[model samples]
Target: MRNVLEAKNINKYFKKPVLFHVLKDISFEIKRGEFASIMGKSGSGKSTLLYILSTMDTDYKGDLYLNEEHVTGKPSVELSQLRNKHIGFVFQFHYLLLEFSVLENVMLPAKKLAQLSHEEIEHNAMQKLKMLHIDHLAKKRANRISGGEKQRVAIARALINNPSILMGDEPTGNLDSYNAKNVFDIFKQLKEEAGLSLLVVTHDEDFASKTDRIIQMEDGHIIHR
Candidate 1:
């Protein structure tokens, strides 16, 4: 299978109070259509590694690639563009614009991309909502929805641009077991039905165990893969 994301010899340092190495020669790859989870205790550098892989943290030393294209050291504007086009993100918080309608929140990314017309973007937004079984909530104000609904809407927004990989930072962290399972099922469906690659950072042992692979980290190094 082709790699959707790869990191090679990644090293990160923090120069605050004292110079500290946060990541040490981290390297891994997520293949197309694979579902992988990163598991670690606090300070393990799992989140830090993810940020670097997501192309948002560029201060680390190493090589990073997305869809076989080298992305390290690229200009911010170009990296932003690549992120919009290739990656989908879900975080612990929904971060939706509460005042806007659900449809509008999902449409925002595509609108910023501007590669599609208004009508086309709107149509795609609805399709994503429907796929996530949240179509009925499309016209509701984002703040009016329940927590699970809000997270599903966030997932819809993430899928707006048809990203090649979906990255999550404790996406199920804020949910109850039932809702977390719902989110996990949705992710499984996306992997099986949509053939999307997934990389999730999770604390839930049950959540991590169900993924295809679990990458365990400790003290800024990968202990198991």
Candidate 2:
């Protein structure tokens, strides 16, 4: 399979009173339509790696290739556009707007794309929400839903633009075992149904095992896979 994303010799450092290196020469490749996991303990730099891959943070040393295009040191505006069009993110928190209805939250990214009419965006949002089994909550305020529903809404929002890659940071961290399992199942379904490329950061061994491949991180470095 062709690679959808690749990282070469990635190194990230944080500077304060002193310098702290968070990632040291990290590298990996994700194939199109593959489900993969990055597993690590707290402070292992998994989130940082995901942010770099998603173009959320670019002040790092390395090369990133997305869909065969080199993406290091690109202007923020360009990076933002690329991210919006090709990448989707799901954080540990749902990060939904409490004031917005579930459908509205899902429509937010489509609105930014500026390619779809309002009606078209709404129709697409409803379809994605239905795919996640959250269509019944589309009219409800995000804050009024259960944690599981909120996370599913977030997933729907992420898929609104039909991104080529889905990057998740501890997506099930806040849920109970049952809900976490459900969320993982949803990811599995996404891979099977949509052929979505997924790279999830996780601490759970069982959850990581569910993916096609697993990369293990330790102290800001990829130790093994």
Candidate 3:
């Protein structure tokens, strides 16, 4: 299979009062359709590495490739476009617009991308919702759903754009044990049915172990992969 993402000798530093290295020459490749998790304790720089991979933090020193295309140091405008087209993100908090209906929230990104008409956007959004088994709640306000349901809605929204890679930071961090497993099952289902590559940062051992590979980081370096 082809590689979906590659990082080469990535290094990051932060300076508030003094220079501090946060990432130490991190490198890895994630194949297309593979599900992987990055695990590390607090201050291990896993989240910082994630931010770099997501193209949200470009201050690092290294090269990043997505589908063999070099994306490191790209302008923010171009990165923004790339993110909308190829990268989908899920967070611990659903971050859904409480005032908007489920369907609207899912359709929002695709609408901004404008690759499809209103009719097509709605159709695609509904299909994603159904795939997540939340179509019945499409008309409900985002705030009306339970925590598990809201997380599912967030996943549907993330998939609405058909991103090649899905990145999650503490995706299950906010859910209870049962709901965390539920989210993991949904992630697995999505990978099986949609062939999407996943990179998730999670502390739950059960959830991380279920992924195809585990990348463990410590003190700004990958200790295991």
Candidate 4:
């Protein structure tokens, strides 16, 4: 498979009264259509690493390449465009707008990109929701859905823009065991069906073990793969 994302000698530091290095010389590469998981204990910089890779936090030292384009140090506007066009993110909590229905929430990203007309957006949103088996909840308010359903809606929203890569930060953290398993299964199915690269940070070893590759982090560094 071709490389979709690559990071070399990545380092992240947090400074307040004192400086704390959260990631130390991290290097990794993810290929197209690959499913990989980052496993770590709390405070191990798992989410921090994902944020850096997702371009949500760029105050770090390293080289990052997405689809073979150098992404480090890009202007905020350019970075936002890149993220909007090529990347999708799923967080532990479903960050859907409580005021909108499932369909509207799924259409949010495409709306921001302004690349689709009203009909196109609605059609695409429904398609994604259907793909995730959540189309039946299209008219339900985001806040009214169950946790698993909410996560599914978030997944649908993430995929509505057809991003080439999906970054997940403990997506199943708030789910029960059954729901977590279902979410993982959905992720696997989406990775196969969409042909998109997946990089997930998961505390659940069982879930991580199901992925194609497992990256273990400790002391803010990748210790195993």
Overall lDDT per candidate, in order of appearance: 0.96, 0.92, 0.93, 0.92
Candidates, ranked, TM-score? 1, 3, 4, 2
Worst 10 residues of 4 by lDDT: 187-196
Q: Where does candidate 2 have its weakest 10-residue lDDT segment?
A: 76-85
Candidate 2 Cα outliers beyond 4 Å, as residue runs: none
| Clash totals, every prediction | 0, 0, 0, 0
lDDT of 2 by residue, 1-225 (tens): 989999999999999868999999998899988999999888999999999999888899999999989999899988988898899999999999999999999999999988889999999999998898889999999989999899999999999999999999999999899999998998898899889999999988889997999999999999986
Question: Which candidate wins on TM-score?
Answer: 1
Please report how far candidate 3 places residue 106 from its true position, in Å.
0.7
* lDDT tens per residue, model 3, 98-191: 9999999999999989889999999999999988888999999998989999998899888888999999999999999999999999889878
Per-residue alpha-carbon lDDT of candidate 4 for residues 1-225, written as tens digits (9 for 90 to 100): 788999999999999769999899999999999999999899998999999999989999999999989999999999998998899999999999999999999998999988879899999999888888889999999888888899999998888889989999999999999999998998899788878899999999999999999999999999997
Off by over 4 Å in 1: none
Q: Candidate 4: TM-score?
A: 0.98
Cα RMSD to native, each candidate? Answer: 0.5, 1.0, 0.8, 0.9
Report the number of the highest-lDDT candidate. 1
lDDT of 3 at 196: 91
lDDT of 4 at 209: 92
